[model samples]
Target: MKHINLLLLLIVTTITIVLLWQGAQTREKESQLLEVISRHSKASDPSKSSDLTRNSAPGGAARPSAAAFEPDHFLTELNSLLDSAGTDSRTVQRAMRMFLFDNKGKLASASPKALKEACNKIEADWATDAKSFVWLELVSEIVKSDPAWAIRNIDRFLMTIAKEQPMEKMLHYLGKNGRLGDPAWSPEYAAELEKWFDTAEADGRLKGMDEEAAGMRFDLNISLGNLLGAVEQLTHLPEDSLSTRLEDLAASSSAPSGQRGLVEAVAAAVPATDFQDFTRALSQHAGFDSARELLARAELTAERHDLAAAGIAAADIGPQTAARADWLITTLRDKDAGAVTGFAAAWTQAAHKDTAAWLTSLPAGDARDAAVAGFAPAIARLDGATAAKWGLTLENPSLRTSVMDHVYREWHQQEPEAAAEYFGR
Candidate 1:
């Protein structure tokens, strides 16, 4: 009887532990389900909350699944919403956004044939102006999935543009839906797009739209991720319109690396005479890190390095600027200090008399302070007394001290007597 009791107790304990483990697993799954629902719900409608809760298992029924969020269920629901009379277009859009955000992975899984079929069905069912947006929205998502198909079926999108819509509106649709700026794009896709644009122009789709066509080409080349090709296209635009467009491009998020490609392209293409204005525009729009990146990547020929140095000298290097500028300085100093020194030397060379005169004429301000900080050490090594005198002119006292200390050390190493005499005064 005692042996029987011990066996029964062991069985009961084992059953209890199994039940507890299953209960913990259920709770964890429920938590995950709630999180996914909550996230998609917020994206769908900020005002509404998800009603999806963990249903109690009856007779050991299977757990809740995300089958409702899958494409088959969503497509059926989308069609139902579309068929329902008096359904606000916004409702459909919100559903689509939520579905796309949650199941964006579907882009990879959904076969191109399925996508093409969906696009065909949507085109066949084109019934009302209200439902027109559905075609474009799906096309945008499709472009994200299969860009080559999107390019081949480009006219399906172009035809949707109303004749009354302004060229800007058409451009916006192309930009947003074409996914032209998506970084995942390949060079071959870009070349194909370039050919398509050329064909469009030759076939009269872009007739009498030279300026707009050029703008689109610039954007496409930028999308190509080829800095030189994008820069080369800039020359095709009207001179008067180029600066405004370049500024817009510099400020645009449409480039692969955001503004970095446009920055590099423009830096390479700009005439040495206009670098200061270009740098300032970049500083105002993109920030100093872009300028540093441009400098870092430049081939640094005599003309190029001197022009870039002058531009960097004139632009804002304030505490309010990106902290990455300091990081860049420290990093460059650690890895390749000679490059910075060589750049400063080239800028101060007699061949760059105009650049030197411009620097000299600048009043004491952030530009001057930056210039002093950048060039003082090189000047110290070249002419110790002159560099020591130049470092004292900086407006930021801490910056002044820091630059002066560096300058003095170099100067002292070069000419200790001159450095001592200069500081003693």
Candidate 2:
């Protein structure tokens, strides 16, 4: 009778423990919709939130599963709303804005004819009010539903234009639905664009309307990067001769400087034997110009058995190497060739010498910061042989806590036993 009571008590305790654990899990798994859907049918950007917790200083707010925010629900609601509408353009425009906010090809089964009719309906009835927008949604639909139509209608729907016209936004979409769809630009359109550029150069938005001009220039700056990226894809510039066009782009005064900077960064990705040449080319940006490129170079150098060169290159990359660490530990591994001491020392110096300065130089933005924070954990996850080699080769005691914590916290939940072994728990 006493034994039965003991078993019963144990069973009750186990059930209580399991129930508590499940409750905590459920709490952690908040419904993403109830949390942030200003309404049931639109994707309110988390960026709009005034709450500091939503945009925490570091490590980011814990994300609920991204998949939980289903576009299908919004699309279903949109279709039902559209079906009941009474030929109202404002109503149609509102529906389109909702559709665009959750743009993920939800109604992908609709045919090309249906898409054309949809585009026509939106174009004819799109609202002139600042209170709502449907053009971006319509443009996104045309782009995905039919790239050919996107190409054909490129002139009709560009979001930005140098000058305001009664229907320029619609025409902009028709021209570059996907990149100057009509390869042969009408001479008249070319002349118009040229005239716009001349106005930008002469009266110059700087003197005429500085604020609006600056905004327009900012938009133009972004467009040029995509334009050049598209051009590169279409041309498929050979690996060896990649820099020629890039050089041309940088030297062209009309080439947007921001776009040129991006082009310079991408060109640095081309694999090559001469580290010196690649480093020299990318250093022009003044924005820790060599961080990502040098990180890549360090990997290549370690692979080539040029340990001294790799170390020097890593040092040149400075502290930002720790943040630009897309693959620092992997870069150091260099196959199963075991560890190279020089590469390890170089990396330690680059990361530890000026920790704050190095963090400062890395890419800006929340995602970049999180990766920077994880740099140590990344190094901790190195294979056993490499980790041991790394331990013996370096002497930075300050770094151990971060590296160990990164590994233990990361691996513990997923593989607790292995994580215990990793942290020597």
Please name the candidate that would achieve the greatest TM-score relative to the true structure: 1
Using all chains and alpha carbons, the TM-scores for the candidates as numbered come to 0.43, 0.26
lDDT of 2 by residue, 1-425 (tens): 99999999999999999999988755543232223223333233443344423332234463322233233343344445455443556544544443343433333444556556555654555444321243344444545544545543543343232235413343343333323322333333333433454454584332544333333332233344333432333133344553543333333323333443443344344443332233333343322333434433432434443332233234445545554333433344444322223333335434543433444454543322333343333344443323333333223344444445555665565666776775578
lDDT of 1 by residue, 187-306 (tens): 555566677777766767765666766766776765665545656766667766667655645554333354444545565666644444555556556556656666566554544444
Worst 10 residues of 1 by lDDT: 54-63
RMSD of each: 17.8, 20.1
Considering every candidate listed, which one attains the maximal lDDT? 1
Which parts of model 1 have CA positions greater than 4 angstroms off?
Answer: 1-76, 85-108, 160-170, 176-185, 207-215, 223-226, 235-273, 276-309, 312-425
* CA shift of 57, model 1, Å: 27
